[model samples]
Target: MSAVASETKTRQLPYVVAITEGVREVLKEQANAFVAGEDVAGAGSVYGYYRGLLDEFGADRIYDTPISEKGIIGLGVGAAAAGLRPVLDIMFMDFIGECMDEIANQMAKMRFMFGGSATLPITVLTMAGAGANLAAQHSQSLEAWLAHLPGLKVVMPATPYDAKGLIIAAARDDNPVFVVLNKMSLAMMGDVPEGPYEVPIGKANVVRTGKNYTIVTLGRMLGQALDAAKQLAELGIDAEVIDARSVQPFDTEAVIKSVEKTHRAMVVHEAVRFGGFGAEIAAQIQEHAFDYLDAPVARVGAPFSPVPFSPALEKVYVPNAERIVVVAREQLGI
Candidate 1:
């Protein structure tokens, strides 16, 4: 089901504010839910999304932990296993390396290893993407790492609406859910409904409907894909755009269906091209709709290198609509 609401009572909220509101509503609804992470309680997080949450939820519910990703994630795993819903914040997604053991082995496999007896209802909120010039260590899109895990659900919400809805949905889930948010989109604004709402995980949204060609996008790349669609339309190519909101339980059906109609498809993402999630999407499209494909499935992503610190290089390093349009044209022979 599409997560977007068509109600006329919606109001514009920045991507960061929507996230804060989502967490607020989750804490309000789930009595057992609590949020803990570095600088989240005292400084309201590095991105300022958690601003004012500590005062609203109190210290017990909103905790300030030491600068340790392993300890923070470990706390969530233990807390969730003990019946409390914990929202753990990993300040930068690149730091997932420091706590790989906790995530890959413990938090992700506790349920199955225990024969389904233990439940790790852990919701990890981490910042991703590379437009803020946070350098290599601080900026990265590592959703593929979590998505590859067996017992984890990975979600990348592009807009303010999905950011809010997905957060609430992740909090209420019974398994580990990673909400990979884009740091560059924090100031982006969109319509969001008041109160709590859930955007179902593992669902894809057809943001733009077209014929001729299909453009499947992940996370922040949705906007670029849409822009490329418009530019392609001007050049007599109607491109259908599908947002792969969830990466692990990817919405293969939506993409395959679009490819069947369009006969050509391309996957786009902010992560590096090699060994990126877009490769997985491209493979799925070919495997499911190979007979109907007019051309090989194409992929557009950042180069396989660390996110540059130089603003000039970083601007070129990130994938944009022009790149997508060029790739689509080359693949489509238009």
Candidate 2:
């Protein structure tokens, strides 16, 4: 069993359901918290994670807005600034382009621009990743964009547990937080604790322990990395797998500690390899654990092309366990 699946006692739930529960719990906990986005209430979200939320919370708390991404985010920024905790939905991660000004300039820099006098306790949830053939426009893992901005917390949850926990944690945080979710993993199931719980932002989870190598993965790549670890184990390689749940306030200590022990590290993500967050992680590893490294840190990610619409092309576009194994062997020379 995988490290996450090995845990017992917690009930199993789909990643999509966990998100619903997380948002529901957040609204229940925070009286001022409200959910706003296009088709979120009536459509129960384009992914069904927000299903039944309208019936449960009513329109006062759950709102369905127009199809304007900028307006949706603008409303969220204004509402959050006015002392209400808003859980805004940016239907698709790619839609962030429409609201970059609200996100980058207003939501991200407002608190700092005001010298900590203002707090934007906003949680922006958006779907990312390339699978289910959503194509380039709809299926881009753009977490790097949000992570690059200052004063914004970026988190990518790979499993159902992290999805629910991270969402709740993001909602509770005082600063603006982006819960970058994977649309392809919505149907994936995992053990999740019941009720409101936090997975804590800025912390990395070492899912699989090994002595030889460390494979730090972000978002949906956690499963692929674990699969690759299993494949490597068959060939006399023990690989430690770390889930980088949060990227901006990255858990450098966890990754550095792992690299210090294993003396070899690689970072992987679904974003474009040219300037993905993997580059940032690889750089951090070299800086913090240069003496411990036995080889240059490796990175695995997609090509710098747009996500393909065809299933055949997408299968080749997105990085998989085979690609990870190939890169690992080339880097480790084994």
C-alpha local distance difference test of each model: 0.92, 0.93
lDDT of 1 by residue, 53-78 (tens): 88898998999999888999999999
In order of listing, the candidates' clash counts read 0, 0
Model 2 has an lDDT value of: 0.93
Cα shift from native, residue 11, model 1 (Å) = 0.6
Q: In model 1, which regions exceed 4 Å deviation?
A: 1-8
TM-scores, all candidates, are 0.97, 0.97
Over 1-334, each residue of candidate 2 has an lDDT whose tens digit, in order, gives 1233333357899999999989999999999999999899999998999999899999999999999988988998899889999999999999999999999999999999899889899999999999779899999999888899999999999999999999999999998999999998999999887777888999999999999899999999999999999999998889999999999899999999999999999899999998999999999998989999999999999998999999999999999999999999999998
* Cα error of candidate 2 at position 234, Å: 1.4
Q: What pairs collide in candidate 1?
A: none
Candidate 2 clashing pairs, residues 3+ apart or interchain: none
Worst 10 residues of 2 by lDDT: 1-10
On the 0 to 100 scale, the lDDT of residue 308 in model 2 is 95
State the lDDT at 300 in candidate 2: 97
Q: Tell me how far the alpha carbon of residue 230 in candidate 2 is from the true structure, in angstroms, after superposition.
A: 0.4
